[model samples]
Each structure stands twice: as structure tokens, then as C-alpha cells.
Target: MTYIWTGKRWAYLAMVIDLYARKPVGWATSLSPNSELTSNALKMAYESRGRPEGVMFHSDQGSHYTSHK
Candidate 1:
């Protein structure tokens, strides 16, 4: 997780990178980091990438990622 100073307060940034191209494919920013933040980024990446199959995801063992939601 990365925190950015927006001048007034800190904001969270979630990003999904296309490892093959070494570029960012999707991203989201919010005041808080939660399942929604990560999910939204992943969803955007999935849709933007044409919903490819057999993809692999890696992340830290955060509860948000482990949540059933």
C-alpha cells in the first residue's frame, strides 16, 4: 500500500500493473484502503485487459484480500 499526501490529507493509491508490458494497467485512489479499493483496481484491470483467463494475482496477506466480499 502506498500513501500520498494530497496537501490536505493522505490518500491511498491502489494500482495493478501489467507485468508483461511493465506498465500500469489500472489504478484507484481513495481516502482509505479497503477491499473495495483493491477490488476496484483489479476489476478495472480485468475489464481493460479484455478479461483474459488463467491470470495470476499476487499480494500481501491482507485481510481485505482474504475477505469473502
Candidate 2:
């Protein structure tokens, strides 16, 4: 949890992990998660881990990755 003091209370965080090496390449802490947070995690993962040219990325039925926005 990020403990985001949202003017009223603490908050939580949603995280994204890469199964490739069993590590969190990206994560986001927010009052709540949206597509943006997911995308940031993905971006961080790519940057931190050096985006493989054709590596396959997999995720569940999360709309964030599916939305393609």
C-alpha cells in the first residue's frame, strides 16, 4: 500500500508484474488504479528491463492492457 493521504484517508496500490523473471518491472500506487497506472507500470518495465524486441507479454482479462488506448 502507498498510504496516499487523499485528503481524508490512506489509499492502496495496484501492481503489475512480469512473469518472465518473477519480478515487478513496474507498479503504481494510487487512490485507485486506472489504465494510466497500468500503462505507467508497463512503460517502467520496458525501460527498466530493456524492452525485448519481440518478447511476449501476457496478462489476465484486465481491460487496461486490452483497451489499447
**Model 1 per-residue lDDT tens digits across residues 1-69:** 578999999999888899899998888888998889888888999999999999987878687667777
Candidate 2 TM-score, C-alpha based:
0.68
lDDT, residue 40, candidate 2: 74
Worst 10 residues of 2 by lDDT: 1-10
Please report the candidate that would top lDDT against the real structure: 1
Give residue 12's lDDT in candidate 1 (0 to 100): 92
Give the per-residue lDDT digits (tens) of candidate 2, residues 1-69: 234667897665555577867877777766665777667767777788777688677777677667766
* Lowest lDDT block of 10, candidate 1: 60-69
TM per model?
Answer: 0.88, 0.68
TM-score between candidate 1 and the true structure = 0.88
As a whole number from 0 to 100, the lDDT of residue 50 in candidate 1 is 99
